[model samples]
Target: MSSTTLVIGGTGKTGRKVVQQLRALGEPVRIGSRRNSPPFDWENPATWPAALAGIDRLYVSFQPDLAVPGAAKAISDLTYLAVAGGVRKVVLLSGKGEQEAERCERIVADSGIPYTILRASWFSQNFSESFLMEPILSGTVALPKPEAPIPYVDTGDIAEVAVQSLLDDRHDGRIYELTGPRQLTFPEVVEEIAAATRRYIRYVPVPLEEYVEGLRNHDLPPDYVWLIGYLFGEVLGKPGNEDVSGDIERVLGRPARDFSDYVRETADSGIWNRVPSSS
Candidate 1:
């Protein structure tokens, strides 16, 4: 059996880290991305088999998100192909509180392949690397769900756990809920960033509908707007979503990175210090 591991979404947030860590451990890895040799695209099933060929292990991070429509069927089809191709183990990155993502989890679990699921809280990097970055750069983060206390886990921790799951069969069939050690509300997050960067950043809480309308007004894709709305409405502030989990410590023998730690490190990188351009 081939020992190669295929990391789907390998260029993405957690995927890239997983790839890096695996490579650091001297494990064979193939990046499954549209730009790779055997391109793996989520929307195109024809690209999958080639990427899965000769691969014994897999790391699944769905593009956009698994909450989107058709994600379950996509996971189902991918796992089916993997099983037929003799892929031995699979590790999936999933959203902590998303019901829709759970459906995709079931597909991978029942696929007759050994699997581990990492159900993660909202990422701390969302503020520095994702949609929230723009608002931070603009100095005013007008978002909904101001009061929702989120245990924003770092992608670094998530990646470490993922790498452990991929290489060690001990993690097989285990579902790990990954979260940071503390919860912070939107305003508190802003304050931490503000202090770390020594820049004035404001957090304005808006109505959910108003926030969605703002995204539409800015001409963001309809699907992206829909996802933002779904995440804020369905997942944020829901009970238990804010609770911190010790799974990271359990898996990696260390406490999960705190949001403040992320903020300080990212601040040192000067990502939050960039001057916003005036149009």
Candidate 2:
């Protein structure tokens, strides 16, 4: 029953939704992002203590990705500070296929706080707001994941679950693996977008090498390239991950939104209708 909720990565896809939901429920929400008040920068550990000062509960999301290097150690360090600062509850966002992400989850469980783990599938927003957005706006999306079937979870559902977990003590210690109700391959997902937007969207299968080179050609950092490569090449295609999960329904008592629904919704948002940002 913590009223003051701290959401890290609070400006990103799922975090933004979580913040909106918490505020809608009349909870006092604090955003923990590089630009948020009491700014929290993951690379700068000095800012961690200030962000945790008044927080009794936390929705912790690491930046870029949880699968990246040093994530576990960073989580471990942050959890120590949270515990020391009187944090009693935590909801950690985790990647479904990432062992590294799980390492961070374990650290939170060991932090002696009431905790919930939301092991999320690839996000539908990956195409609309994340790395895939640019490629889509350019009319061609290329990646290493051509045949890799994914159950892309909606950010809305992830936020709903996160808000519930932060507010409900009964949900503590639960590990929920949330996915969409159906699975889709990259090309198939692209086709769904094409159908939704009434436009042609092509999906190309590229080797990891070529994808990294593409990232470099855009003057992006290698860290971004490496993270993207790992997700597309390592996490996207797999048997255990391709199936849908009912955790979203079980937690929220409603069916998860489909990829087609997400595409249609985002298509109208004008996010896809305009030129994608180069940032």
Candidate 3:
């Protein structure tokens, strides 16, 4: 019998891929996004019990982020509802170095549910889809730090592991630290994209305060600003995690996708095709 899984953040990069993979595997997949059918919102606990009902497994990808305020409490409260609603297995998509995210992880660990935690590095899609995409398209990528080496992971790998964890019991109680095959600084990544698209992309390194001011001027959330600041300030430029993880290959029986592959794919997809201004 196939398991019925509720996939939260179903429209996100990893969650979307997970939903696709699960549906392809013939499992009953329920999308748990506020925008999707049977809306599931973290801020609204009243919706939890309904979404958790009949869900044997859950792929938990917290939106905006899990590191924000009240996330731990939300996860804790949801754990009770999940267990009460008969959810047996849960796979969480988490940031590798986030303390607030770790709090949510602990909530699930103690929730008596079969769980797998994927502590992922910065996603390669940040450039292709997220905040970095805007700057990349403008051809002037300016960040707080230029020397920061981010071991960005592909969302594809994260989704693959999440699906296995949800479908297979072998990954229970495991924490997987997922990263890219190689580490590249911000400037180096810009160069890679430039090399791939054959466009002259520029990387302007700014002070942390300047970066924050830039974001503030745009009315970006301070929570998002904190997340990015914590990441680039605390986690990046670390040497111990500079190499690719064996967890992806070990779990999937395949090599992790290279950064070059991600860049080439993004380039061919025509997602970044604006003719940059010369000024």
lDDT of each: 0.92, 0.87, 0.84
- Model 3, poorest ten-residue lDDT window? 235-244
Candidate 3 lDDT over 1-279, as tens digits, reads: 667889988888898999999898888999998986678997788888778878888898886778878788888888888888878898988887676688899999999999999999889998977878878988889986686667788999999989888878899999999987777889999999999988888999898877877777877788887777766666666565455678988889998888899999999998778654453
Candidate that beats the other on lDDT, 1 or 3, i.e. the better one: 1
- Output the number of the TM-score-best candidate: 1
Give the Å error, residue 195, model 2: 1.7
Clashing pairs in 2: none
Model 2 lDDT at residue 259: 85
Model 2, range 69-150, lDDT digits (tens) per residue?
Answer: 8787899899999888888899999988776677788899988999999999989998877667888888888877687788
Candidate 3, 67: how far from true, in Å?
A: 1.9
TM-score per prediction, in order, is 0.97, 0.94, 0.94
